[model samples]
Target: MSSINTNKKNTITWLLLLLFTVISVYIGEVLELFTTQKSLFIGAVLFIVFLKGQQIIDVFMELKYAPKLWRRLLLGYVILLPIIIGIIYLV
Candidate 1:
């Protein structure tokens, strides 16, 4: 019974995450279409997107329950990825 409930909860969480992601994408696209100049709304939208990304990464990667070594490795990759991309772009 507990396992069944757990499954249901996880399913709901996933569905909510999907819905939020879709809504965020649509909002960002609409904002882009109507706005020519940057605004505060742009910042808000970016923050929401980043928050959603963190949620997805935490859930999908199971980082919340992972070992210390695994968590550190994941963090290292996350930290290095942006730097690597920036260097590549610069080159």
Candidate 2:
């Protein structure tokens, strides 16, 4: 029973990640947001990336039950990534 549930959850998570990737590509190419809304484009992409990172960490890595220090460190890394990317975009 547990195995089936876990498999289902993993499948859903994978699908969501794929959808996010498609959305990012659509934003970058189809929408051509970079030409006028560079900041918005970056913000949208970073937000999706952050969500994707959290999904991977919690679901795939199974880190939700891990020690507080370890979990926090991983989450902190995920949170920090967008900040770094945003800074790079600005530069």
Candidate 3:
């Protein structure tokens, strides 16, 4: 039963990641022509990237059940990028 649930969770994660990838691609390719707000789309793409990073860390890395310290160590990098982007944009 546990294995079945894990499989289901993994499948769902994979699908969600795929969906995010599609959305990211759409924003990068299709949406650019329709919108003039470059920062907004860039921010949206960054948010999606952050989501993908979290998914990769927690699911693909099998760190969902890991120790808090270890998880935070990896997640910190994922979390840091958006802040850095924000800083760059603000300056």
Q: Which stretches in model 1 have alpha-carbon errors above 4 Å?
A: 38-49, 75-91
lDDT of 3 by residue, 1-91 (tens): 3999989989999999999999999998866888887787778888898999999999989988899998898889888998799668756
TM-score for each candidate, following the candidate numbering: 0.53, 0.89, 0.83
Full-model lDDT for every candidate? 0.63, 0.88, 0.88
lDDT of 1 by residue, 36-63 (tens): 6445345545555555555555666667
Clashes of each: 0, 0, 0
Candidate 2 per-residue C-alpha lDDT over 26-88 given as tens digits, one digit per residue, 9 for 90 to 100? 887844634776777888888889999999999899988888888799989999989999989
**Worst window of 10 by summed lDDT in candidate 1:** 37-46
Clashes of 1: 0
lDDT (Cα) of model 1: 0.63
- Model 1, position 53: C-alpha lDDT score: 52
Which candidate order results from sorting by TM-score in descending order? 2, 3, 1
Which run of 10 residues does model 2 get worst, by summed lDDT?
30-39
| Cα TM-score of candidate 3 | 0.83
